[model samples]
Target: MEKVIILTGASRGIGRAAALMLAKENIVVMASRDINALIELKKEIGASGGKSEALPCDVAKENEVKKMIEDTIQKFGRIDVLINNAGFGIFKRADKFSLEEVENLFRVNLFGVFLCVKYTAPYMIEKKNGQIINISSVAGLNGFKGGSAYSATKFALNGYSESLREDLKEFGIAVSLVCPGGVNTGFGGAVADGKISRDFLLEPEDVARTIKYLVDESETANAKMIELKPRRRKEFR
Candidate 1:
């Protein structure tokens, strides 16, 4: 049977690419705030003879997140995989940073991950098998000067993923985190402080492949955490 995958942030970038890649052989429920874009992606997947459903969801909202999970379960009967990829980041200095914006950022980046896992894990625990792949950033591993909010959220996500991995192990559920460095995704706009020298930029598809590998790995060899960075050069963005 084809696995049913719920992918958030499926409107663009890594999430979009991962949805397209997984839909080839899996039943994908694509969720994101961009309903229009999700529809377009679903159409493209249909053209390729892949199966998918476009479910508009704002991961930050608890009610909406609950509904998204319910809607997926109603349609697919079970969810075998969940890719938490919705996130937003902006460059801001500490002195000038907007606390309101930081709170909003954490809502989607950090809390979003928690909400998804909380709702999805119970079903996995019941089934005794599932895979959760969280898309984090290199910022989680190394802090940059201007990325106060984004870095903090990702750092929190990393810690959460580590603990979740251990907790799910006994239930036969695998949890993995994919941390990629400076992808070509245009969301990563400006770079200040330049602490993490972006000498090489990874492609969104590269991270997608890593996710697929983790999903396809043997059950015994649970791939816990994966970090991807392009081979270093002199300089990049």
Candidate 2:
């Protein structure tokens, strides 16, 4: 049977790659704040003879999150997987970050994941079958200079995913976290500045393939957490 999947942050980077890959075999509902990008992706998926739907959503806002979930349910009848890939990063010294900036980051990165799960879990629980994949970072496992604020959110996400896994296990919903290191994306607005080299970073397709693995794995086997990093370390720093 084809699974109905809701993928947040579908506009770019890992989310975009995952949407394209998943849509080839399953129904993908692409959610992101960039409606135009989602539309373009939708068209691309259609061109390839894949199923997809584009939705404009800001995961940090509860109303928008609720509406997106509700709308997906209305359209699909059931959601077989929820990929919480909507996130961004703001790198700076801990003291350099403004309170509002920290708050906004947490809202989108941490609280937003919670909101999506909160609204979507009930359906999964009722069905006793679903998958939730949270896209995290290696920053969650290790700290770095100028990454205090961003690291903190990912660390919190790590802890959250751990507990969520335990909570949902009994309900038969699998919660998995994917922590990738140094992806060659425009994340944190760093790629354009030439601060990092694309040669050493993991491609978004790499992470997308990992996501496909988790989705295709047998129901009895739950990959609690998967960490992915580029084989060649980023030397530029």
Candidate 3:
């Protein structure tokens, strides 16, 4: 049987690319906030003879997340892999950004990951087999100017992923934290307040391949972290 995969933030960008690519090889249940985009994605994959389903979800909301997981379990029976890729970036200096906005950043990028992992882990543990891939950014591994809020959330994700990897390894669950540099996607459009480096950038498809690589690894090969950077040097944004 094909692996059962759950992915968040699947409406666009890296999440969307990952969902499409993975569906070619596995059964993918994609969650995202945009119902219309989800429909498009579902149709595209279904037309291609791939197995996929899209559900409307907002990872920042705990109740929504809970419902999504419950519904996923009801549909798929169990989750074999989870891709925590839902996130938002609010770029602004600490002085300019509101506390609410900063908190929103953390809610989606960090806390959202926590919520998804919390909901999905039990099923994986029960099966004694699974993989969790958290799509962190280079910002998680390194700091960037004007991105204090985004960086802070990603930094938290890095630490969370590290700790969880140790805790889950004993249960046959593999956790891989992906730290991608610049991926050409809606993320650039979302950066209304923060400026991203304009030099060479990684494509969302490339990052999706990284995610696929990690998820497809043999149960014996547990990759903890993988970082993707531009082939050319660019000043930090």
Model number with the top TM-score: 2
Q: Write the per-residue lDDT of candidate 1 for residues 1-237, one digit (tens) a residue.
A: 589999999999888888889889899899999899999999999999999999988999999999999999988899899999999887768677788988988999999989998999999999999999998988888887678888899999999999998999998888888888777665653532354444466777988889888767776777778878776744322
lDDT of 1: 0.86
The residue pairs that clash in candidate 3, if any, are none
Going through the candidates in order, what is the number of backbone clashes in each? 0, 0, 0
- Checking candidate 2 for backbone clashes, the offending pairs are none
162-194: candidate 3 lDDT, tens digit per residue: 999999998999999999887777673234323
- 10 residues in a row with least lDDT, candidate 3: 188-197
Sequence-dependent TM-score of model 3? 0.95
Comparing 1 with 2 on TM-score, the higher-scoring candidate is 2
* Candidate 1 Cα outliers beyond 4 Å, as residue runs: 191-199, 234-237
Give the lDDT of residue 237 in candidate 2: 32
Please give the distance, in angstroms, between residue 199's alpha carbon in candidate 1 and its true position after superposition: 7.6
TM-score to true structure, per model:
0.93, 0.96, 0.95
Candidate 1: which pairs clash? none
**Candidate numbers sorted by lDDT from highest down:** 2, 3, 1
Candidate 1 positional error at 73, Å: 0.6
lDDT to native, each model = 0.86, 0.90, 0.87
